[model samples]
Target chain A: MAIDERMEGIEAVFLDLDGTIYLGGELIEGASEFLDRLDHRGVKRFFLSNNSSRSVSQYLRKLTRLGIPAREEEVLLSTHDLLNWLEAEGIDDTFLVGTQGMGEMLEARGIRTQSKSPQAVVLGYDTEITYQKLSDASMYLHAGVPLVASHPDLVCPSPVGGLPDVGAYLSLFETTTGVRPVKVCGKPNPSMILGMIGELGLDVECCAMIGDSIYTDMAMADASGVHGILVLSGEATAEDAATSNVRMSLIAPSVDSLCR
Target chain B: MAIDERMEGIEAVFLDLDGTIYLGGELIEGASEFLDRLDHRGVKRFFLSNNSSRSVSQYLRKLTRLGIPAREEEVLLSTHDLLNWLEAEGIDDTFLVGTQGMGEMLEARGIRTQSKSPQAVVLGYDTEITYQKLSDASMYLHAGVPLVASHPDLVCPSPVGGLPDVGAYLSLFETTTGVRPVKVCGKPNPSMILGMIGELGLDVECCAMIGDSIYTDMAMADASGVHGILVLSGEATAEDAATSNVRMSLIAPSVDSLCR
Candidate 1:
């Protein structure tokens, strides 16, 4: 099938939150209309996000607050994605260096969390960091624990300013222990996209990834052989899309243009 | 007096242990004869070592086993040197990353050991290391803690092979924390030698340094404007001394030859 024909046959759609479907607490104009069109067409849809600061249920609640109907199962978060990957990889326990939300998520997935002699070190967005915690994590790394990071971003921009992210911690550990992380399970990596595709049982070529971050969203599409749509509602501007290595299949001012 | 005249006047001498006196538990042949000659001259002498792996009492025991007479105050260890320097600098409390020997030495000198919110990081040769210790040190560095390293040897040779020394750890931490040590108080730097000179109340030109390692012992003499005697008893071979950057005032097969 031709690229556009494959896109036309897309049985499932994966949407990125924050910059794609909504910004802050407001949905982009016509996001509901686009979802309604997908519903009418009988397409399976889900929202996959790299943000680990919030849980899937929290995202669902936010969607509800924004008048977008989202089921609990249809929202896949990085924390959940990591848990799934760990379970599939036969990792039943991990030394977690993240927030309580991530700890809860890991425990919910039947993974035991321990500070001593852990099989792997899982890093998420942690705001409550301490010197003791950093030392304990470094000890685990020095003792040769496998490392898995949720995302590769060095900084995450918030309402106030940019804060140190997973990449910053990774750099510190790498410098001290001379060991870099073996794998990352979010964003620009195609493994997460492929997992989403498998979970949704979608035809790969027809699926489109629409988001504001070209590095992650478009890169994921390019790597997974899916159509990429760049939207100007969030992080990336039109100029960023033009200079980006991942070519966009379509450009829309907002989700409103998709249905029109 | 001229350096040559001072060299002629020297009757007794002090020597550094590791890298200077002997390496890896083996006595430098002719070292015993050198000491015997110094004894015959009724020269006041002692041995100084910066290695903190063992206590002064332990060093005395080791020296006794090796057929060298050692008294408590006669053997000036790195711990002693550091304590003296700390007292002279008026630093009562310091964050030290070293062994029990270092801790004992600091305590004996009335210097307090504080790891958290440390005023400065005083590094020594620590045999026992953990990731937590390194992480804590990094945190202190990030918080703008002044770094003071005991020595600058990248690796210290052991009976089995070589281990990363203080310099290696400093290199790794500097890469991550963007802070290098402010001062190194060991051989090849003039401060330690000059300090020793001040303690002995000897003129710089009148003092002579005799040791096996050309890079450290000879270079120290060169830097301090003192006469240096290179002995073939420890780390450096005769070939190394010939090609080394350190210029020597005298070459001796052993301390016995120096007396001749």
Candidate 2:
């Protein structure tokens, strides 16, 4: 299918937030117009973010404040996937090294964020990471406890540049304890969006995965059998997408131009 | 030359400490006997260790406590190499993430170990590492300061198992900043032993590098034209040496068997 033609069949869209809709605190140009176009076309759209530092409520507030009003059901996070994974594995106790907001999300799900005898060590994008957390996690890992991470993004896109993310934290653990994460739940792991897609009664063929990062967004689309759409409004350049093996169904300059 | 034949011309020995001489607090079986044999043979022996958390005086104290009877001049440490490298580069200002003992050594050398405007981030086997140290190191690395590590040993051997070392800390910094060390001064670097060899007016071919690790001791030997001797009392098994690419000139059951 042609780049523009692929959009015709996309009845539902999974949109990445940070790079696609906004970069840091400022909203991207044409993002609102693109969302309006999706609304006009009766396309079901959902906001997906791999940043586990913020909870769903925080994301809702941020989105609303940015003029892109999002309901609770319409926003999905890696934290949700982490919660689901923990529940399925019967993991009620974990030593979590994440933000206060992330702590609340885990606690609300009945997962103890700080257990002395934790079954596993759960890692996230912890901007508030401390030495105690790192030391404790290393001790648990050395004791043969499994590790679970929220995502595998090496760096998060920022206005200044890339900032360390969960992937970097995972590397630290690996070097310290010679242990790797048993599970990483987020973008590039198809289950992040597959559950929501199933719940929406959406056909996989008519669903498009859209984002700025080729590795996470496009790779997830490939894994989940959704139409991968690459937006150049963020981290990845056209040259990057061209050289990458990921087959993007559509390559747009931005969501606005694609929608227009 | 045959494995035993290579030892015939050896006039001096460069011995690794942790696995070769002592395992934690206790000396390895026959370690004393091995040293006595080398002493009887009129061979000069130097203790070469990649463990940089301890200074030379601390190592001398530990050696004397263990009944090894080591002199200050007979001790060669990764810290010595780090100091030499710093001096060569004329770097007096560094952000050091190491032990208090290591801090004292750098300070004595007229090097600022805790400068806000550091020329480099110097890493060592810091058992007393704090989160503040790690966070500060990451910030400096992100700000484009070059990283210089004392050694590249991932884990230090302990009585029970392995403990995190400078290499582990280096991994953490790499993940957080996407930066690797500009220089790593320690075993297998050749310069660690080469300088002493030149000072002693000893031929490299007449010296034997004996240790338990093939990657460090034997690899250093290969790089500096010294006879490589492998002991089976530490990290590498006989099976491992059999499959490895590093060519060892001799293999022994332990330092005892090699000396005898």
Candidate 3:
């Protein structure tokens, strides 16, 4: 399908949830209004996040609780993208250093989890990190298992300052094994964005990415050759956005200001 | 105190522990015999390890268990060195991202541990790393806290391969906080070797760095204009040692073969 120049002409709008639509459990002011405008325009909207801490179903439920109606299929989480990628590669047995959500995601794809001889090492936002787990992951990496990181964020902003996420584990693995990850499949990576665009069969030229973090959201736009709109309702300020390589085409205070 | 070239002229022998005496838990072959020979030679041997996971007392205990006669005062651990250095600098409050051993060592030196308003950041080999610890350290580093790393071994050799040590943490802090450590007070850092040489009242030319790891032990010798004797008892193999920039004066099977 041919893509149009304006955002209204686009078939899909992929949104970053945390720090973009909401902070913590509260929605950003005007986020619901922005969604209502999208609904009125009959444009498809998808909530995408790199956080593998929760499932897409959970994200959908959260959005509903915030008075924004979102279906299960409309939300794309990192775990969902990872499982889809793994299935496409025809992989079965793997070692996971992440949450139970990741384990469930892999199991749902009919992939067997093996600690001893895992074909690949999947890293996610794991809260239950033990020394044994770290040792096993390091061993797997040293044995030349393909390393895949869920995201590249070093820290995730919390209500209190910042928290170490998947990137912390990734750093440890890199240090111990002297091996950097081969692939990172998340919001910032173009492959994930292209996959999302492919589902809608939309032309890349007309799409616009809206999010709070310029590093990920705007970079995704630049990578996909699309326009990016950065909203200052979340993590990044306008000054922070200005310093990025990805030029912001539209500047809005929040998602609510986008419709006007 | 005029330092002489003869082995008998040496009063105190500063020895690197990791590669020279042992690799991980198991003692290097003939290492105990080498210590026995030192006793016969009337040389006061001090076991020095850049590893900050344990204290001097702990090292002494471990060495005593391994059949090497050692006292807590004769063991120089990195944390002990750091605490001494901090005290000399007149710094009382510090933020430490290390083990309980390191914390205890610093506390013994009267340096208060501050998570928020730390005057300096003392990094050590913390086996039990948490996201909160890394986050706090990064913040302190970003705030321009004077950074001092205990050592520079990116990976510590373990029974199960290698694990990320203090150097790895320094790297992570560098990447996240955009600040490189100003000082690394461990082997190969010049300052550490010089400090030990001064304590022994030995000239740099008369001193010899006898250890296993070429990067740390031999590199320290090369940098400080001292003799570097490589032992094949730890981390680096003979082949790996051959290609290093550090001059390998004597390639012995163990420290026992050093003065034979």
Query: Model-by-model lDDT, in order?
Result: 0.71, 0.86, 0.74
Candidate 1 overall Cα lDDT vs. reference? 0.71
| Per-residue lDDT over B1-260 for candidate 2, one digit per residue giving the tens place of the 0 to 100 score | 44483266678899999888887888889889888978888888999999988988899999999998888889999998999999999999999999888999899999999999999999998877664677677778888999999999987765434667778777777877879999999998999899999998998878889999999999998899888898888888999899988877888878877655
Error of 2 at A177 (Å): 6.7
Question: Lowest summed lDDT over 10 consecutive residues: which window, candidate 3 chain B?
Answer: B1-10
Chain A TM-score per candidate?
Answer: 0.89, 0.96, 0.91
| lDDT of candidate 1 over B89-180, digit per residue (tens) | 77876888777777787777777766456777888877665435565666677778888887776556554234456665576566546678
| Ranking of models by DockQ | 3, 2, 1
Best lDDT among the predictions, by candidate number: 2
Q: Which ten residues in a row have the lowest lDDT in candidate 1 chain A?
A: A155-164
User: Could you report the Cα RMSD, in angstroms, for every candidate shown?
Assistant: 9.3, 5.3, 3.8
Top-TM-score structure, candidate number:
3
Candidate 2 or 1, higher lDDT:
2
Worst 10 residues of 1 chain B by lDDT: B2-11
Report the lDDT tens digits of candidate 3 across residue range A144-252: 8998877888777765445667776677677778888877778787776777788678788656778888888888877887667787888888788777777667767
Error of 2 at B83 (Å): 2.4
Model 1, which residues run further than 4 Å from truth? A1-260, B1-8, B253-257
Clash pairs of candidate 1? Answer: none
Give each candidate's interface RMSD in Å: 8.3, 3.3, 2.5
